[model samples]
Target: MLKGQPRATSPRPAISPAPGASEVFQLLRDGQPRTRAELAQLTGLARSSVASRVDTLMGLGLVAPYGGAASTGGRPPSLFALNPGARAVVAADIGATHARAILADLSGRELAEERQALTIGDGPDAVLGWLAGTVGTLLARGGLPASELAAIGIGLPGPVEHRTGRPINPPIMPGWDRFDVPARVQESYDVPVLVDNDVNIMALGERSFHWPGTTELMFVKVATGIGAGIISGGSLQRGAQGTAGDLGHVRVAYGGEVVCRCGNTGCLEALAGGPALVAALNERTGGTLTSSQDVIELVRSGDAGAVQVIRQAGRDIGDVLAACVNLINPSVIVIGGSLAQAGEHLLAGIREVVYQRSLPLATEHLRIVPSVAGDRAGVTGAAVLAIDHVLSPESIEAACAALTTG
Candidate 1:
């Protein structure tokens, strides 16, 4: 959860800095309702101040009364909770070969969802058009009007300039180089549009959904392309280039002969991504596998050749992650994406190398596990991004002010 604002100083308690609407909203965001006295005690604000903030949030439909709480004495104070039905958020996870769209309430509950076989190479116009249409379909499914939509979040399978929501020199996305994804999507639905790397959002989703308590975490996606979403000190780190987690393109000491899609040699992706794993299995199993799904099924069926290939790929990935462990030392490392569906084979290989090579201290308490969200991690994370955007302190304050004036 995001932190609240600083308190104002005054001589009288009545004039003490009241909690801002955003601050109060954050407290209620957990779906727990509290009386104004409880809020004042927690925030050290005056009862009057808390009431003002509550009234502001209620004005915008962001908070509502949740009936009464058991009173210690006198009349019971009214309990207020987050009003999740105020508006819906649209989330899209666009991959190399497919896309997923979902509508979620402000509280991050999925209202409706749809998946489709959309190609990235289809360019921004075609892809954005389809996504917009999908958003409309979801709105209809949820019985929501366009006006009920508050924000749109997208997770693209490439590096994204988060400030502008544009893809930056993505290797596989042919026509999306520096394309303004948010602006394009905003054309259809004029709302706050957020965009980020698919793995970054996956990391956000994994953390928010499964490990909200863990502060240091890493989400590694091992599909056609490979990347990592880093959460350091409870915040997602994109670094200076928004490619902070491009683990796939990291050079491998032993794979100098391998060519990567980024026109580089010896990248981890070139050696261990899903496509690379499938290709390796074909060499051993006489070309029986084609897609990442094929690789997963083969591994599940206990095919020795496929298992060996995936384990090797995991080892290669672990080689990169070992370095990450030593450098960042995240407590939780979640392996996600289609390849992760192969289960323990990949995790075993990664754990084997990560534990063996990483520093003892770094490896001691580290837990590398498969993703909980599975195939839906991307979409889940996308929704989280939008939810965070709308619920952010600054955004909440601004939106409430707008509503108050309107």
Candidate 2:
């Protein structure tokens, strides 16, 4: 079954007095057909209540009745399952250098996707305007009308206050401090707007789509900047202020020699980030290489200088992650982002340091691997965010109630 969105406020959502449509809907999330009696038995609700919930869900197009199950005697009971095409959401993954968007159905299937090179430095107005326009384009391409848009989920390359969908003071994102991103996009699309730090959403995407079984996981993004998406207890950790995984600014041994975009000196990002590696490469080879993609290509082509630099960056990241193993003790560490694509050198450095430095008990079953979701990590995760919100028991109850009233 697809994982629901994590709630930071509570370990789990509160249960209602009786099983609601959300509970009945969850019974069919696995695409299995079940009779009202089966759902009633599972949820401990009366068959009539289960029937009512199913009817409400069917009216909302989230549930559909199909066929029937075998019966011991008399007539077979009808079965109901979740409808994948019931609703749609627009998912956007915005980075410092590029932007991507996708239109996805209730089942998290991408109906349409588009990508373009853009800079977050262009500021919020330009970026959000383009995002709003992209959402419309995706809806049209996917043949979904505006009425079917349930919500919009976005991942921004910055620290975001999840409740308000506003960016905090982000180093790489200029003119986006405390900017109301949801409001800007909501002007174009009236549906709910959800925003989160890009890497956090990527973690959600990676886990929901690929590693749903892993209870404890961490998604480490090594790109133009550095960050980690920590999953403990099968839920995303947002910390006290929602910046728990901000690993880039951790102080390192450089000792104020290097400055970061956040105006800090001796940050890990300044030491091992993409720009740092690029600068180190240019200084050594006297070649002007731009972006994390350039460093990746150089390393792929067997440039020893680029290889050595990326490896050390991995070690630098591992140095911090080693402490993470001791504290959080995750079962898996997934390396992703542009720099992680530089081949085994980066992974080798990380493994070498992580295993060597971490506790024996912690490293015994720890698995450090590269990301499988690739570029789809952000958008898929964005979709997961929207999907979790729109299909949640509370949201479904409200929607179903509205349908019944109408």
TM-scores of the candidates in the order shown: 0.93, 0.91
Question: Which 10 consecutive positions of candidate 2 have the poorest summed lDDT?
Answer: 5-14
Clashing pairs in 2: none
Candidate maximizing TM-score: 1
210-322 per-residue lDDT for model 2 (tens digits): 89899899999998889999899998898877898988999876446688877889888898888999998899989999888899998999988888998998888888899
Q: Candidate 1 overall Cα lDDT vs. reference?
A: 0.87
Residue 49 lDDT, candidate 2, scale 0-100: 90
Error of 1 at 164 (Å): 0.2
Q: Quote the lDDT for 403 in model 2.
A: 59
- Give per-candidate clash totals: 0, 0
Off by over 4 Å in 1: 1-19
